[model samples]
Target: MKIDDVVKDTLGRWAEEATVPQGLADRALRRRRRSRVRAFAVMAGATATVVATALTVPALVQPSGGEAGVILAEGKPADDPAISLTGPPEVSADPDATPPTKLVATEKTAMYAYYTWDNEKISDTRQILKQTWYLYNPDSATYEKTPWAAVDVAAGGHVAVLEEAQARRVGLLGPEGQVRWIDLEQPASQLKWSPDGRKLLLVSYAANPNEQGVFDEDGSSREIVPVTRTGFSVVDVAAGQAFFRPLPAGGDAWGRSVDLHWSDDGTLIWDWDTGSESSPPPRRFYDLEGRPHAAPPDPADTGQEAGLSPTGRFSAIHSPDRSAIAAVRDTSSGAITPLKPVAGHWIEQAIAWSGDDHLITWACELKGSAGCEVSEFRNRLLLVSVDGRQAVPLTGFRQNSQKPGSWEPLFARR
Candidate 1:
C-alpha cells in the first residue's frame, strides 16, 4: 500500500478510539501528527532502493566497521574550535505565561534548547510519542524552531537530528555550517549528544523506541510500556565513524525506564537492567561498545540531580527533615542551608549548574498550599542560587498539557 494510505488508515482507526482523549485525535492542521505515524509505516514497507534515493547526501561513506556511515561536507574536517556563551544579560524572571521563545542561558546551559511531546494512538496496545524540538541558535541569541521528530543539542550548540521521523539515519549540523551524517545499521528513534559534543549515542529498537503502548490494551488500564529496544550505536562525528552493539536480552521491560544517557564523565553510557517483575530495575551502566560496565561513582553524591555545583561547594539535596522542601547543602560540611520559597512555588530538582553557586531547576506550583507539592505536574525552569537567596525565572510555568505551552523542557549544556 502507498505510504500515505497506510498512515491515513492507521490514524483513521485511532481517531475512532473511545478509550483515549480527543486531544490526541483532534489532528488540527497546526498540530498534525502525520510525520509521527509515517515513521512506523515507512519502516515496514520501505525498500533499499527507496532508502538509498532518500538519503540524498552526496558524500556518503562507510564507517570503519564496513557499515554505512555517511559524512557529507567539503574540504577536510577541521578541529572543533572553542565555544562561549555571551549575549544579552541573563534575565532573572518572566511572568508565567506562554512558552518563551526568547530564553536566557548561562555559560554552561541553554534554555532555548528544549522539546515537547505529542501522543498518537496507533493500536489498542500501542501509541507513539512525537517530539518537537526547539534548538538554541547562538547566532540569533534566541530559540530557532525545528519540526524534526527527534533531535538533540550539545553543550557547544551542535545538533544531532533524525533527519526524518523514520529513524533510519542520523544527521549532524554544526554551528559552523559543518554538515555530517551517520547511517546506523538498525533503525533508531533516540539521539543524545555526548557532553563534549564529539559523539552521539543513538538508541536503536525493533520498532520506533518512542512507542509507549498501553501496558494492557485489551483492558481499561492506561499504563504505558516502551517498545523493544534492540541495540545502540555510538557515532564519532569528527572521526566519521559509528559502532553498533546489541543490548543484553533478559528481564521484564514492562514500564521500564528506557531513556539512555551518557555517564557524567562521558566515558560510558547507562540504562536500567530490568531483572525481575516484582522489583525495581537497577541502574545499569555500559561502555561505548555497549559492554557491561560499572556505574559512574558520585564522589560527593548529593542525592540531587545536579550532583555537585561547579566548585564542589554546594548541592541541592532533599531537606534532612522536610521532604517537601529542597535543601542547599554545603558538600564540605554537609550542613543544610535554608531555602526561601517563592510566592506560590518551591524549587525541586536541580537540572544544571548555571554558575559555581546557582542552578537551573524547576520551581513547582503550590496553589495556596502550606507545603510544596514535590511531584506536582505544574512547574517551570528556574535558576536558584545554592544559598537559596536568589530565585530567578527562566521560562514561564509549564505543565503536562497537550499544548506545547506546558511540556517538559530538555535543557542542553552550553
Candidate 2:
C-alpha cells in the first residue's frame, strides 16, 4: 500500500492490532491523572536543538545496570526557556492542599522518577522555583516532605534529599521542623542522586535573566530578560563538591536546551547540536567530557524526542517514521542502531523505553491532507516492540488536539 494510504486509514479511525481490554481507557486515564506532575514536570524544561539544557530529574529513581547503556530525548525538540507552574506558590497555602509526601510506583523498578514542588518565590523576580527531583524505592511510594523540600530513597535503602543545597550538610529535624543540616544555599534546578545514592546531578543556571516586566495574555511587549544558558554539575553527595560541564562552546545549542537521561551503565545521553555553519547540521551524542561520539548520518534526518530504553543499551528517537528511532549498543567497539519504520499512524510525542525492549507511543490525529483519515480528531496509544513488529493499538481517546499526552512503561509488568 502507498504510505499516504496507510497513514490515512490509520488516522481516520482508531486502528490498532492490539485489543483495548475492558476498563483499559479508564485505567489509562487514571494513570495519566496520577502521573501528570511526574510526566510534565521534567518535560516542561526540555529544549529544542537550539535551546538551554535543563535537568528535570524524576522524584522516584530506580537504579539501572549492565555493561553499556541506552540514551534517549523526549518530545518535539522545541526551544522553550519559559517556566510554567501548576499549583500556587509554596508559601501561604492551606495546609490541607499539600499531599502527604511518599514514594510512588514509576513504570520500571529501575525507572527514572520525575516530580515537582512549588515553593514561594521570596523575590518577586523569581518564579516559585518548581524544583524537580528523582527519588527511588519505598521512599518513592511513602516519602514525606518538610517545607520547601522533598526526601528520596535509593535501592540500597539509603535516603537523601534530591536538593543541591541539602548536600552542604544534612541533619535530623526536630519535632518542630527545625533543620539541623541548615542548608544555606538556594536550591538547584534539576537535582537527582545517582543509583548508589552517593552522588548528585544538580543543574544550575549559568545566567539569571532580568525580568523586564509581566504582560497580559495578549501579545503585548513585556520587558523581560530571556533565560539563556543553563549549566550542569555532578556532585559527590557526601563530599558536597561538584564537577561542572558547561554549555557546549560556541554552539547554537548553548541556549537551545535538551533533556538528560542516564544509561544503565551511567553514561550521560543528551540531544545536542553538532553541525556548524561550515558543517552539516545534525543532533549528536557527547560523553561527560563534552566529546562527540554518535553523530547521525543525515543532519535533517536527525530528529528529536529521544528516549533511552530501560536496559540502557538502546535508544529510540521519535520522528516522522519508526525509522527515526535510533538504538545504540555500548560495547568495546560501540554500535549504532538505526530507526526502523513501524506500520500505522503515530503522534510526535515522547517515547518510553520499556523493560522488555518494547516501544510505546501516543499516536495523534493526522490531518486529512496529511493523508491519514483515521479520525479528524481521534488519538490512540501504540505498543510496538523494538524487534520491528507491526504497531499494535492498545487504547484510544478523543483527541484533545491541545494538551494530548500519553505514557510508556519503563518495565514490563512483573
Candidate 3:
C-alpha cells in the first residue's frame, strides 16, 4: 500500500481502538464546550479559515511539552574576515528620549519575535512576545526595530502569515494590513514559510496526557505525556487551501526539539537530527501529501548539512578554534572558502542566502571579562559576502538574562 493509505489505515485503527476514561471524557466535553463559546466570540468579527461546522481535530503532538527550542550545532568544516579590526561597531551611546513606535518599513528588513519583560520577574516564560522587524540604518550606522506581530513572511515582504495566539487561528496579512483568518482544527505552534514563499509548514501538538483535574486534590497526579511527532499541514497561500496528513505511525518519539528545513525546490521538508554527534542523522523527507519519501542519497557527511545554502552547492562552516568566523564548503569537492569574520565576534549559523554571493548569518560578540567563551556572548543578524570582504550588521546585539541571546532571526531576500 502507498504511504498515504498506510497513514489513513493507522489513524482509522487508532480511532477505533482508542478509549477515553469516563472522567477524562467528561473533562474533554467540558473543555470543548468552552472552546466552542470562545471560538464563536472570536470569529464574530474576524475572517475565519474554517467554518463552524467543520470537524476539529484534537491538539496534535508537538516535539515535547508543546514547546520547541532552538538548536545550534557545532563542528569544524571537514575542508574550511577583514572589514573591521577594532570589532563590531558599537550602537549609539545616547539613549532615545522615547522608544521608536514604528519600524523602518523596507523590503530588506527581516521580522522576528522580540520578547521583553512584562514584569520584573527574570523568567522568560513570563515575558511578553512582540513581533519585531530589524532594519539597518546607514546614517546612524545601527539597526533599528519596528514592532510587528507576524508568524511568517513571504520572500518579497508582500504577504505575511499571522497567528492569533489566544484564539488559535492563523491569518494572512497583506502589504496593506488586510487580514484573512484561517481556522485550524488543531492548535499549531511552528509556522515555516517555504523558500519560494508559496507554501507554509504548520506543526501542531498532540493532546497533553497529563492534564490536571478541575479541582486540585491531594495525590492528584497527571499522566506523563510522551513526546511524539503529531503531523504537519501544508498551506498554499494562493489557493487558500490547507492539507493536513497524519503520520503513518504514532509519530517519532524524539521529544519536542526538532529543526525543520525545506528543500530548495519546496517539494520536501527535512527534519534534521538534534543529537550531539558529528555524523548526520538518517535522512527523512516528507512530500506535500505528508507521505514519507525514500531517503535521498547522502550528500556529504560534512556536519554542515543543517546550514546548506539555497543552491545546495555550499554549506556554511565555522572555524575549529571558535574564532567567530565562518566559511563555505563545496559539498561535492569539499573545498572551503573562508569568509570575513567580524572582529571580536563569531558567526552563529548561516540562516539564508541573498543571491549566490552573500549569506545571512547570526554574529555574536565574545563576552566575559576573563576570556571569550562560546557560551557567553550576544548575537545580532548580519549579511556577509562570501569573499571575506563585506560584513553588514543588520541588528544590534540582543542579550537578556533569561535567554542565552535574542531569538533567532528568519531571513529572506527582496
Candidate 4:
C-alpha cells in the first residue's frame, strides 16, 4: 500500500485527523490572493510598512532617522541641527520638533516602559501614574498630563487604571475623565487589552488577603492565615460586568503563571498544566465565553504555541522545539499545513502576529544559549514571513546603538 493510504488507514485511531485536501488548497489560495493585494499596497507606499491599526486612526509608523525630523531609508534619525551627531542628544530640540510620524521602540534604558495598543502613546514608569499621565502626542511631538496613565486608545478611548492607595480596586476611566465602574473586591495586579481592542482582561490572584484577616492597615497580623485562591477574571467593557475563571486543579501545576495571550479576535490562548512532562502535552484553548475551542490537531505530531490568526479564521501552532510551524486549515477544519522553519527556539522568544495569517513579528535572541540567565545578552528583533520563511534583521535593535527614530505601530492596513 502507498504511504498516503497507510497513513489514511490508521488515521481513524487518532482523536483528531486532517481534513480533506481540497479544502486546505482552497484556503491556501485565498490566503495567497490576500497577500498579493497587500504586497501591491506596500509597493505603492514605499516610504514605510505598517505593523498594526485601529478604528479610523492612522496606525503608528517608525520613520527612519536622518536630516533631523526626517525618516531615513535605513530607518535611523539624524542629530538635531543644534547638537553634534557625535553623541546622543542630551536635551530636547524645541517642542516643535516634529515627532516622527511613527514611534520606533529601539534600545531603551528607562527603568519602566508602557507600550500602548496604538504604540503612539508611551508612559515612562519613572514619571506617570494614576494621578498623573504623561501623554505623548506624535502628531505635534508634545506631551502633557492626562487624567489616566497608559490608556488603551486603540479601543473606544477607554482607560483602565489602578486606583491610588486602593491595593485591590481597579477603575476604568472615560474620555472626559469620568469614573465608569470599579472592581472593589478583586485585586488584579496586571491589566491587558484584547487584541481586537474591544475588551480588557484583568489577571489577578483569586484570594483577597484583606478579607482573611492576614494583615491590617498597620501591617499587623495576629495569627497565621492559610488560604487557597489563584486565577484570572475576564471583564466585559461594554456591559460593565466581570466573570471570574478559576485555574485548573491538579498537582505539579504551575499556578497563575504569566504568558497568557489573546488573539486578535479576542480568543484567549494558553497552556494547561499537564504536569511537568517534557513537552506538557494536550494544550487547550478558551473562547471569550470560556468554551473549549481547539481548531483540530495535526495528524503527524502534537502542537505547541497555538496562536490564532489576526482574522481568526485559521490558527497556527509551532513544534515544541521550534523546528516547524503548523497551522490549521480553518476555524472548523482540522487539516494542517506545516510551514518551513521560520525561527530557532521560538518558545524562548516573543512572536507577534501582524495584520494577517501569513506574516508575524519574530523577536528572539540573535546569539547565545537561549538561556534565562543569558537572555539579556541575546536580545534582538527579527521580521519574518510565514510563507517565505525569510528572516530579516530590524536595525533599530542594534546593540548599544540609539534607535533611528520614534516609530509607532501602524497596523497592516487591511
Candidate 5:
C-alpha cells in the first residue's frame, strides 16, 4: 500500500484492530515496523526519484539510495482478495490525463499526498478494498511511494502522522523518512497535525473504519464493526507529551471515519456529527479537554468543508446556481459574489484557500450540469483566482472519478 493509502484508509482508516485484507496486514504489520518502530528509527539519508512533470520548477533528479524512501515487502501475498496496483494519470495540466501523475502547487499551498485504490470481491457478499498512495517530495518536486496503512501530512507538508497497528503509540514522520515515536496509552485510528505545526491530535478508535461487514436476515454473517470511539489526545509536537481526554461514545456507534479536524485558528478540533438523518451538519467544535465547544466562526450554509478562509473574512463555496459556477460569501455583509467563467465553461470548487485572493481548487473538464455531480466530474487540482479569471493546474484530471476508491488529494501549506 502507498504511504497515502497508508492514509486513504484514514480518508475512510489509519491503524486498525478490525480485519483487513491479508495483503494489507502483511504489508502494514511488518517485523521491522512492529519491532524496530519502537526505538528511535535512524534517519537514513534518501535520494529523490526523477519524475516527469509539466511544472516549470527547475527539476533535480538524483539516483536512488539503496532503499531510502522505499520499504520492502517481507512475505508473499496471501490468497484472499488479490491486489492490482494502478498509477494515477499524468501530473498537472494536459487535460488528457486523469488523477494526475505530476501535481504542482503554489509556495503557500501544495498537494502533499494523494491516494488511488482498487476493490476486489472476496465473496458474494464481501469485497476487500486496497489503496496505493503518493507522497509529494518538495525537495525533488516528485511524489514518492511508502507503506502506511493510513497517513496525514502535517500543516507544512514537512511531516506525516501515522500510528502503529495494534500498538499504543503514534509516529511523527519527518522529511527524510525518520520517525519520532511517542508512546500513547491508547491506539489512535487517525492523527491530525495542527496548522501551526506545533501539536498532534490523535483520534482513538476500536477498529479500522475502512472495513465493515454485513449479514443475512437470519443472522448468518459475523459482525465486522469494531468498538466506537473512546476519546482523543492532544500532544505537543516538540515536547512529545500527551494530554489524554476521555469522551466515550455511548450506545451510538460512531466509527473513526467521523474523523476529527482542527479549526482554522488551530485553537480547537471538531467533527461534523450526522446524528440520524441530517447531512452536511454544521461544525461541532471541541476544546482541548474534549468539552463540546462553540459553533464555527462562519456557517457552512452551502455545506462546504473548510469553506471559511484562514482570516475568517470570506467563505468559499460552489456557486448556488447550476450555471454561475464558483462563488464566495462576504462574511461581514452576507453578500455572495459569483466568479467569472474561464474557458467559456470554467467552474471552480474553492476548497483550500492560499490567502485572501487565491485558492487551491478542483478544475473540471466535463461541461454543463453533469459536471457539477461527483460521478460525472473529472477533476484536477488547480490554483485559481477568486474572480475566476486566472487558473493554474495543480494536478491532471482524475480517472474513474465515479468510483469511491478514486484518487483524493491531501492539501498542505508549503
Candidate 6:
C-alpha cells in the first residue's frame, strides 16, 4: 500500500520474471545488506532541520587559486609532508633493461616506461625524451622491450591501449600483436581499462587544458598540466565501437583531479569528485546509453578515500597514525587489520589487487631530517599481502629524477 512497498513489489516481480545472473544477484544482495546498515545509522542521528537544510542547498566547495588547503578528512596528520628520495639506478646494460630487484610473485608481469638519459627521440619534449616501454619478465628476471607505446594494459595481458608517435590516432593492441586503431578528434589525456577488460575509457582535452600554475620568487610562473581533455569516450573492444561524450562546460572545474572508473558489473560508469575536502563527493553515474542515473545511497561516512579491491571484498586503507603503514579493511564488518608495514617506507597509492590475497601498491621511504618534497621523492612498486607478510619489490630502483617523476607501473596477470 505504501510507496516503498509498491516499489519493492515491482522489483520483486521483475526479479521473478527476468533471468538474472547468479553473480549479479549475489552482488545486489551484498549491496542491499550494506545499504540497510548505512540507512539505519543515518536515521538514528538525522533531524528534521538537517534534512530540510540539505535539500535546499548545493554542496559545492570552490577551490582557492594557489595550492588547495589540506583538509585531512581521513584523520591524517595535517603536517604530513610529501615523501622524497634520490634518483633510481642508472641503466648500464642493454636498452631494454629491467630493475635489479626481483619480485616474489613470479606469476605476474609489469609494464612501465623506462627512462634513460640516452636514446633516440621521437619528439623533443620536457618529459618524453628517451622514454621507451619495457615488459618485466618475472620468469627470466629480465626486461623485454615492446614496440608499441602502451598507455594502459588490460588484465591477463590480453589487450593494451597504445598511442603512436605523432600519429593522431589511438590503437588497441590485442593478444596476437594485432592492432585496431581508433581515430580521435582531439588529443587524449588519460586511458583506463575496465575491471572486466572488455571496455576502455579514453578522456580527451580541448582549449582550456587541465593545468595549474606554480610561481617562482621572481613572480614568473610555469604551468603544470597533466590531462587537458574535457570529453570522454568508451570503446567496446569486442564490437570495435567507440562512443564519444562531451562533458558540460565547467563540469569538472572544482576538482584538482578527474577520476573516471567503471562500475563493478561493467554496466555503468562513475565520475568521482576528487576535489571536495569536507566529504567524499557524491559520485555521478551514467548508464551504458550515456544517460544520467541516480546514485545509490551510502552506508556510512567512512571519512576516507578507501581504495576498494577489484572484487569489492576488501579496502586498502592507511593507518590512523599516518606512519608508513597500510591496512586491509573488511567491507562487510568494517574491521581494520594492519598489513605488515614496509620498514622505512609508507604506502603512496594502492594501484591494483594482484589476486585475492595480494595488493600492488606504490611506496616511498620515510622523510629525512631535511624533509621530503614531492618533486624529489621517488616511489617503488611493491607486492604486499593481506596477512601482513613482507612486501616484495617489483619495479626497478626508485623513480629516476626525471622532470615528471616516475612512470606509473601497470600490472597484468600472466
Indicate the TM-score of model 2: 0.42
Which sections of candidate 3 miss by over 4 Å? 1-150, 162-168, 207-227, 248-254, 258-261, 272-280, 298-306, 310-313, 320-325, 331-333, 339-341, 366-375, 400-405
- What lDDT does the true structure give each of the candidates? 0.57, 0.35, 0.42, 0.34, 0.52, 0.44
Q: Return the TM-score for candidate 6, rounded to 2 decimals.
A: 0.57
- Scored by TM-score, the top model is 1
Segments in model 2 whose C-alpha atoms lie over 4 Å from true places: 1-187, 192-198, 206-217, 220-224, 228-232, 238-315, 318-347, 365-383, 387-414
Taking the tens digit of each residue's C-alpha lDDT, what string does model 2 give over 224-279?
Answer: 44444345566554433455676433223233233233323445534434334423
Candidate 5, residue 35: how far the Cα is off, in Å: 35
lDDT digits (tens) for residues 162-248 of candidate 6: 443232344444222234455554555456666676777766555323234443457575335354336667766655556678753
Ranked by lDDT, the better of candidates 2 and 3 is 3
Task: Give TM-scores for every candidate, taking all chains together and pairing residue i with residue i.
Answer: 0.72, 0.42, 0.55, 0.41, 0.67, 0.57
lDDT digits (tens) for residues 248-272 of candidate 4: 3332223222324353355654444
- Of candidate 2, the 10-residue stretch with the lowest lDDT total is 43-52
Better of 5 and 6 by TM-score: 5
Pick out the ten consecutive residues of candidate 5 with the lowest summed lDDT.
37-46
> Which digits, one per residue and each the tens of the lDDT, describe model 5 over residues 5-102?
75788856434556322123223322212111111111111113311210111112221322122211222211111111123422333334455545
Question: Can you write out model 3's per-residue Cα lDDT over 107-171, one digit (the tens) per residue?
Answer: 23233222222222223222223323333223333334332233454554433333333225455
lDDT of 6 at 127: 28
- Output the number of the lDDT-best candidate: 1
> Residue pairs in steric clash, candidate 1?
155-413
**Pairwise TM-score winner, candidates 1 and 2:** 1
The candidate with the higher lDDT, 2 or 4, is 2
